[model samples]
Target: RLLTKMFSNHLQKKLTTLSTLTDLTISLDGWTDNSGNSLYSFMALKENQEIVLDILDLLADHHTGNFLKDKLKEVLSINGIKILSIIACVTDNPSNIAKVCMGVSVYEQGFRYCLSLSETARPKYPEIENITIKNIISDRYHFANNDALTKVIKPIVDAIGRLESNDSTLADIFKELINIHQQISQLEVPINGLKAHALAIISKRAREFDSDIFFIALFLSPPHKFLAISRKMSGDKIIRASLELAKTWNFKKIDTSLLFKDLLSYKNNDPPFDTPFKSSSQSLRSYWSEFTGNAPLLHRFAMKVLVIVLHGASCERLFSSLGLIKSKIRNRLTPDNLSILGQLRNELKKTVHIKENSNKTVTEFSTYNKARPTGF
Candidate 1:
């Protein structure tokens, strides 16, 4: 019971600190433990200072959404965790949890719009006057005696058909029709000279134009494909400069990789420390040599805490403690009592803070003294 109380105190402190400092990115996973009990694991960056793994919930054989939601609510209440700032959820393919609405499902579809703007060689002859040609090619030339233009638009119509009755995808089809009108706004060919070849060329270009539009739509998509384009742009100074044309009004977040590279290359021996510890501890020695040259003890301690805690082992150890405590007693536990026990176990691992005296110099002593009796 004493050990359990210490654990609770430690966990409470960590959870409080996490809530205070960092924007959290939470991931949840459910699994069966060795004891054949169902458990949900939650991991998050707490306070951006520490990574914490928590047994967010435990459940009986019959688990449901209500069970999950209730457990989430319970955690929030205990931690005083009001809002989730960022969330990343991972699950198996065709996961039912992917559903956003009842009886309605969404499937991601890939589309490419082909534009005729890029020419391999010299420019072709000027396109004939103002008929909107679409890229959709079909063998049929006419629909209800209207002409071949109507047949070219069948794909848009078909896409709209899949949507719910009178939905906005149907409206989007009409919007594309208007876009067609705008494309041929400058064409001046006489109606009588609208030859088969001219119509064919216009149709081809229209298809290409639709493809361009599709690509633009992809930029506004979820799981955006712009990262590849952004990477290419960053590689080209001219492209990056062009993107930053508006000096005052045009600013964008530089990609993190670019920012980190610039930060690391600030000086000949910058970036202070090497995280992966390569080559004989040379960089680390250089960092301390430079740091201890001027900085105080408090600064050294701050840096030490930052570096030592960066690795994920801290959270892993916490998880092991959770297993040690909860695995045997979970079936007999209540949620509230289990949460209390989890909190106590977490605190036991952290070092206690002892304030240094103002007048006296701090000194290290090596003698071991027993504060309490040891028992196996």
Candidate 2:
């Protein structure tokens, strides 16, 4: 118990530092453990790093949207994370989780807009698109159309897969959706029939998982700054959305007027932004880092938006470790003990090194040499 307290304190300090360093995307999902306890895991992700935030044993509490929302608030408050520091909240079950996003205060307005946008973006009966394709395949008694459909659906599936990556950002997701729309639009008539249907579904699903934050992130990303124009999304609209998001994030020190001007300069490819980058593969973080002196406020804001992780896969991934730790033989482990063990396992994976020699792997605690506390 003493060691568990020490480790818990160490992990809490690390989470506090993470909250201060960058904006986080809170990814959450629920599952049942071997002991029949209903567990919901919360993970905080930014850029390429993921921190396990908490695992709640819901016990007999109903998992309704309102109930989950209060629990989410409790977790954030305990971890010292401010509501404004969250870039997005992602989960697999959108129908229920949507309430969690929309029941909050000012942020609820953005989510409300998302729901409205999704409704307006599609026809009332969008499933007819899929039914049309199926009828064609059945009536014609041919499989060629099936192959063509695969080409269209494969890209969309791959794009969704990319979201599960730890490094995926909001801009990456936006770009993928746009690319899928374009790819579908370019297909010939019968295949193109899927265009309106595909686009409507994409817009609806995208908005369900995202909000104006996505557009702002796309505008901030260096390579994608001009891509939105191709989709008829006006620069002014994106700028206004960016400003609104900044306000919601409680960035009081930002000079909106100067930030607007800097946005124009980047959009127009003026001055510093005009100079071609030395490498086409420059990362978003590194690209934004270079502009801190020239566009301080914009740089600060961009860094926050660009670091957001787009999916709840990290939270899901943690469940595998949780399952192993709480196997049938270990079903009696308390939730506190489970959480401590899980965090220690994660931390050790980072600080320990494994070397292979003569068909044997040696485990070495590298942090011991650096005099870092390992909570032993």
Candidate 3:
């Protein structure tokens, strides 16, 4: 009991610190555990790190849009996080979650359909009439269509995976969306039939990309600036969006003329931008850090926008961890205790590494003291 109290206090302190950050992206997901408990996980992502905020057990509560929205507000309020600090909220493509972020910037995961046409759309041969199943399987046209569909869907699945990575940025997502559109639009034959259908879906889902914030993120990305230009995204539009976002953050005294000049120089690959990085694998944030003195405004803006988390994988990961921690044998654990234990496990994962050598498990700590909060 004493240990649980200590951990809970530490987590509260972390939450207090988290509330002070600006332009944070919140990721949410929900799932049911083996013991019939409905659980919802919330996480906050800033820069490259993700902080597991809380997990709620919604006992006897209806999972409606308004209910979920109120619960989310309660969580944010308890943690001292202001709505203004949240740049975006990411979740799966569910109507309730969409409604929760009605007035706020939200990004829903793209449509996911099973690519295996036969397995997904049809039943087993034994289950259906043998003759009918045989005829469907023997159709050459069906095979051709399935092959074409796979070609289109495979790239989208790969793009989704890239976007879900911890290091992925809004710029990366914008580039992927553009690449998907181009790949379909520039096909050898003009759009028709399956291609046209796929293109339409992409267009519908790409509506979120119409927001200038996404374009601004792409514009500020050093490696992707040329890609944005080639895609015909307007520089003037990006500038307007940047200024608008800056004003929201209360940067009223910013030099608009200097920002414009710096953007032009950046786009043109002038002196400071011309130099190659010391390492090819340098991160976008690190790359932007080098030019802070020359492009102070852009650098400050890039640091805020470039780190937006593009997926809800963090919440999904928390659910997975919770499942293991709250197994059948431990099914009786209370919600408060479960949350504390789950958090401790997550913290340990960062500092503890176990290696097996000579049939023995050896545990190593990168920063033992840092892993445990004060007084633990």
TM-score each candidate: 0.32, 0.69, 0.70
Each prediction's total of clashing residue pairs, residues at least 3 apart in sequence or on different chains, is: 21, 0, 0
CA displacement after TM-score superposition, residue 67 of candidate 3 (Å): 4.1
Best by TM-score: 3
Give the better candidate number (1 or 2) by TM-score. 2
TM-score of candidate 3 versus the correct structure, residues matched by position? 0.70
lDDT of 3 by residue, 149-226 (tens): 556665577677788887788888777887888887766433248788878988888875777777787777776776
Q: All models: lDDT?
A: 0.37, 0.70, 0.71
Error of 1 at 263 (Å): 7.2
In model 1, what lDDT does residue 240 have? 33
Model 2 root mean square deviation, Cα atoms: 13.6
Q: Poorest 10 consecutive residues of model 2 by lDDT?
A: 95-104
Q: Write the per-residue lDDT of candidate 1 for residues 165-197, one digit (tens) a residue.
A: 211211232234434444444344333444444
Q: What's model 1's lDDT at 145?
A: 23
Better of 2 and 3 by TM-score: 3
